[model samples]
Target: MTGSFLPYGRHVVDDDDISAVAEVLRGDWLTTGPTVEKFEASLAERVGARFAVACSSGTAGLHMATAVAGLSPGDRAVVPPMTFLATANAVRYQGGDVVFSDVDPQTGLLNIDGVQDIVDRARNGIRAVLPVHLAGQTVDMPSLARLAKKAGFVVIEDACHALGTEYLDGNEVVSVGSCRHSTMAVFSFHPVKTIAMGEGGAVTTNDPDVYRKLLEFRNHGMTREANQFQNRDMALDSDAEPNPWYYEMPSIGFNYRASDIHCALAHSQLKKLNSFIARRRELAARYDEQLQYLSPILLPPLRIEGCNPAWHLYAVRIDFKASGMTRKQVMVRLREAGIGSQVHYIPVHLQPYYRRLYGESSLPGATAYYAATLSLPLFPSMSDGDVGRVVDTLAHCLGMN
Candidate 1:
């Protein structure tokens, strides 16, 4: 590789971002302090949610959501195959069975029809449906929510890639994290995501009970609030004054709390989310314009009306048979040319563990999408020239002018 390597995604950190973290480091409490609450409040307000709980990672956030949704053994949750492992694993963490649903073969998005089929077949024990907003393109949440309401299942959105995405609710523009349709929505702040916090995540919800439950679940099921305490004697002194060190573990929970350092960095990064999304959109348009003429290498799937994607991944579908090159070979060639690419996911059901657990099941949509999808470099900091270079190199590797 002669030129600088271009990764599929990267974080953009400014001096101010460093300064925010530095300020936190200098503060009194580093783990659970005012900065943590401030960060949570900022995220909740940004997404128009009543509450937000910050956690250590996206997986942790998903686990917490599943816990709050009351998933247990014998309870089944619908999970689409075309998502990161964490999306499905979260359900398993709560001792729940996963019913793998298919996605749109073109868009790699969860198909509402596929979910409907699952619900129709299993009328009972369906506790939740997790719809992942893959590649920052939103799922048809309105339709999914209606289905959940009718089927008596909760809807939790895996919106890790869709921090800045928006869609329409009637004539109103609704943000992805607003939880207007779903019961809860989760986001990630990994370096490769829309924002970077080293490792951080948040879940947003409008339901006060769910919000309180999420908070309790994020911190070892411990509650500091005396009102929620089950044991009054231990939580209070003779004068009935709350004991400062007293806390109650009402339910088993994990230590998924996000630190002030991570939250501070994420809070700073959140301020630039709009601009970051705008730049990513600009880069996506450039890819579309330039790659249109290359045959057998299709652009990203067409979005439906009212879907304004955040463009986390500019994944194009290449018909490997027609292109006369395997996906692996193309990736090797691109790497030699200093351009990076990656596959968004393999079907979660096809995983060996899942196959062993659920047995072999056909999901043609997810299978087809996985076979053709290849995510090219896409991030806010890449320049127009970088886009041109990547396209030129990809075209050359594909033997197209």
Candidate 2:
């Protein structure tokens, strides 16, 4: 195992997953069928949400959620610069402006004060506040929701890294996709995520109207349900029964539906979420214990109270400058040792497209956090010995003991 290359993240698929997909492959329905509905229901129940809408990708879920939230031209949404570009781009996709907010230097999560400042200064046209649960850690959603309520904006969570993540809400523990604190929450099922669906995502919400809109937005703004159709004459048959072939497109939307094949695999993976999370927690703890003494070169993720992260990525901060090498140099050396590493993100505000669109803005925390962070190998299939080997190799590569 030591001689084999270890990736920063990978999916763990068993025979059961293959069997589930194979069953779907052998069935009649492959896209937009009963399997998709079953998967949606299971996800909704698991997350304590009233409705769950499955989509093709997390980015698609974000776009649909924003569309349903009424984001429009000239509208602004507060986005932290420390997350993936999709989080911010989703707003732009709706022709809305992205108001970049600074994140906590230590945790790469949005703080209430920073977000509040952005909202206050923007005054009018602030349509939504998107708080990303970076690295599987939940944000202070209760506080963010309160701020959104006060400012008359919606709160949609970009929870791509936090499918199984949980946090305390008052006296009760709630799952990340519950949508109890935010208006809607989104999740990703990429191969590297907590579960694998090849490429899938979902949005969870309790509002009935939003739920209906999400379904419409996922399928080209079209609906087969006669009750929702605007053209009643065309939708109903001669006997007043709904026309079986009738479908209406009321608004512009995208083809973002996840196929039945993907749903079957996702449903199977959902059954083993608890086990996957447990294994990840064990690996994270091992890393925490073993990497404690590598001072001046590394700092493990902060142990936040009241939050149980799903451990999507064991991202650690490394002082490459103090370690006498550039980040690229450190990564190259680690790769030479048959170990893979990655940077979780390079602050979105610093990206070329954003700079050309919004101009440069000062966000020191995001910049500092981006310069030091690194994601090491962490997945459910990795052994305890793998964690030890990663730490040992990292230390050796950095010229530390």
Candidate 3:
């Protein structure tokens, strides 16, 4: 049984998902259709956002937020170091500078002090902040939002890892993508995420004007609404009769539309999101209990109060100095034993692109976290027995005698 390779993450599709896609295949439209609107409305309601815009990918959604938030040339965004490159790269897509913020060394979540550090160090005009919910855990968004408001910069959440994840807002529990504490929040529907849509994403916002901008940008900065037209060519006669095909393209835009087929499948998957989060939490708890005896590896679970994390990945830290083994050696042995594992991240500031752009800088918190972080397999499809096998195999590979 231990010889069966288990991946760190995967999609858990069912017959309903297939049927939904099949129905879409037999329908009239494939790209922009009724299903897309339905999916956006359902998702917006689920996360308590006033509006939602489905897009081709999470990166596109982030770019939409940056564009709608007015990030342009000579603007900067402060982002955490421990995250996927997209979190920072999205700013650059809109011609904005990225300022690196260090995370808490143990939890890998950015904090208020880190924001202060960014303010003190950045020589450019910092206009926005992107707080990443790394490894399915949320930053203190309520506090962070307050800080942003006081500092006069907009906040956008990189909630790609936190779909069903929720946190306390005083007496009420709010979902990460609610946009309750930020200008907007982004979500991904990749197979490895909390929910899968094959390939899709969305941005959620409460601001009507921002939502309108998102709508225009996602579909090539064009609008079919007659009232929104800016050209006299749109008028047919002195009667001011509008052309049914009249549309305006005031600014350059890209094709970032999410197809109806993807939306149909994602809508089906969204129905199971609660159960998926429940199972992931169960697996995470099992790992927490079973791995307590394993030395030199620190397990990170629901460390914060009032956080119901969807647990997109179960990342822990291995103390290589005490284990007397290299990180590469342990990973090799685990792979040989059919137990797959991966590093959650390398410091974003240390990446060659960022390094070349900003030169070298010290970030002790991000460095320490990267030196020890490792992600173990934890998916909704994983059985308790499978988790036991993984723990036993990992123990054996580490030679925990």
Candidate 4:
């Protein structure tokens, strides 16, 4: 085992990025200014979406999107079980119920049939279907869209893991954020994501109404348009107008806006997104080639026929019974050998809060994944030597030789 520690994921920051944030800080406006708009425009252009709305974090973006979708009390949203709790928590933020769906055992993404089952069985004000692209793999959006259309469910993609992924359609590959099949797609720019911005996120949509709602929702339901307000000139007509200090709080909303500094960093990071994704794919390929002979560990599932993954995570399943070691034992041994190993998630439904709120019955597929899965180090910044060290450390921990 190597003496150096290998982490599962890390941000690749450069001097240029630091300079960009520094420049933003030196400017006049620090919050919700010109840089924020520029960052939104850049994100929209890159993702092929007509409009992008920046926010404080991925969870904030999700909440804003769900709000724009008109989810209210008594509404229900369908979500996959094999994802971070935020995916489901965003629904609860709007006082809506979350109906959990099972994931594909191999890819850890939502199963189309499982979604269909949930939509078919939904009753009492089911409003939207939130399909999470787990581990940066593209979900079957086309089929899911069709299902949503037939079932009268609004489709909101929790695309935090799939910023640069593309969906397969025979010979054609469509990007996930094009909103090609869903109403709105959300992305994160956290330190561990494909694009790191310290803390930020955005919502992408082609629908003008949804875009307008998101814009208003993110900024505390206040509109800057003079024409929309009853009193156009608040300062000038203070004595004549009913409420001269005038800004209509048309609807209840939250302050979930991103700062110009974070946006600046995200814009800089966006420039290297393609390169980062390429490197991630390269690393995944190396793992596949080297681990092919290791029967005790199952590598991540292959990309769908025409889909391209961003490769945010490289999770492997261990056959603990066959390997004569438990998953816990393997993880402990790997950490002791100076390799950083972690689990992506413990299915949303299995969490203490979810179990208390939704009842703690085991989801066979999600539980199976949680039991055997371990995320290995796979980031763009890793060197070939680092990759080798990770693989060798795992082999030693698993007692492969």
Q: lDDT per residue, candidate 3, 1-401, as tens digits?
A: 35568999989999999999999999898998899999999999999999999999998998888998889988989999899888889899888888888888887888678897677666764799999998888999999887787778999999999998999989999999999999999999999998888888999999988998899999999877677777866545467878766788877677899999999989999999999999999999999898898854545543677788899999878788777888899889888878788887888898999999999978888998889888999889888998998888777767783
How many steric clashes between backbone atoms does each model show?
A: 0, 0, 0, 0
Model 1, range 287-334, lDDT digits (tens) per residue?
A: 988888885465655666799989889889988888889999999999
Candidate 2 residue pairs in backbone clash: none
Give the clashing pairs for model 3: none
lDDT of 2: 0.92
Could you tell me how far off, in angstroms, the CA of residue 66 lies in candidate 3 after the best superposition? 0.9
Which tens-of-lDDT digit does each residue in 185-226 have in candidate 2?
999999999999999999999999999999999999988888
Task: Indicate whether candidate 3 or candidate 4 has the larger lDDT.
Answer: 3
Residue 224's lDDT in candidate 4: 60
Q: Which candidate do you rate higher for TM-score, 2 or 4?
A: 2
lDDT of 4 by residue, 15-123 (tens): 9999999999999979999999999998999888999999999999999998999888889998888888788999999999888888877677788898777666765
In model 2, the Cα lDDT at residue 277 comes to 97
Question: Would you estimate the TM-scores of all the predictions?
Answer: 0.98, 0.98, 0.97, 0.94
